[model samples]
Target: MKDKTNEISMKKKIKNKAFSLMAKKGLKDISMREIAEACGVTKPVLYYYFKDKEDLCYSLIVEKSVVSNENLKKFAASGASFEEILVFIFSEYMQDISHKDVFPFVIHVSSYLLSNPDLGKRFEVVKEQNFAVISGILEKEYKKGTITKKGKEMALQLIFANLAHLILNSCEHAIKFSPSYPKDMARAILKAIDYREK
Candidate 1:
């Protein structure tokens, strides 16, 4: 039991240190040796916890996405209106990206994904899982003829694009919008996609 506890502790330490380094230097720039040194561990010890840089990064992203998807599921099950749920999602995201540590790490990971499409492909499964929750809700509306196929696609794009904009501005500490920004963004997306509130 003690050995297992120590192993878990060490892995957590390694992940935290690696996240800090990667946030500042990015994935390609930092290495396992550097991550090990930052965690005050040897290269072999680091390897024992993670197979490679990509594995470590993927682990981190999966951890975050799991929690994210859970929240999405909960919101979807909350019996709220679709528009209300969309606004809530945006509001939650704004709160998330406002965190200094989280914002930089997100930016770093996003940059790495954009620059390496092949590597990015590995994350598509997780991305699709996250999107599936939203798409499921949208499909209900589509089936009811409440929204068109194009409208569903446009809604997803608008929400994600606005989220990217929020993250970028938050990273630069240039967020000048009012506290109602989330509601405003949600309204704009619904308007753009011609979504009818049911």
Candidate 2:
């Protein structure tokens, strides 16, 4: 019994290592042998966990997309107003940058994979779920007369589009710009979302 559990745990560790490597070098340059080495294992051990490179990439994509959508949903469920919700979402990104280098690549990889129909479908589903959560929050705020907009679905899309742009922009200059990049991006995103803020 314990042996099976240990094997499963070891497999998970290898899979996570592969995802981390993919985030660093990207899918185009990643190899099974490299992934195994990164995980301190042999190429055959990596193959024991995954069929091939494509299988590893797909698994990572599905895991990441699902986890991200879940987090977004939980954040949107907070009783915060539209502006507060926007701030919370942006602030979460600000907080994650230091601890997890792969954080920024989450959206970047999803956008890059938009060209692949299979991956695009998964991305679209996760995106729709995220937007639905945001739209629900916006609808609540609108009902409370905080947001003067009736078209919440459009508003949610715009907010997410702005977020994606902010992430992309910050990532482009994050290394050279140092801490200023994410800070500036957060401010810009907040300003875009809270146009009526006094």
94-170 per-residue lDDT for model 1 (tens digits):
88876677777877888888999998999998889878877888887788676889999988788778878887888
RMSD value for candidate 1: 2.1
Tens digit of per-residue lDDT, candidate 2, span 69-114: 6776676675544555666666665554444545545654665576
Per model, how many backbone clashes are there?
0, 0
What's the TM for model 2?
Answer: 0.66
Query: What lDDT does the true structure give each of the candidates?
Result: 0.84, 0.64
Candidate 2 regions with alpha-carbon error over 4 angstroms = 1-8, 42-44, 75-78, 98-100, 103-115, 143-145, 148-151, 172-198
TM-score of each: 0.87, 0.66
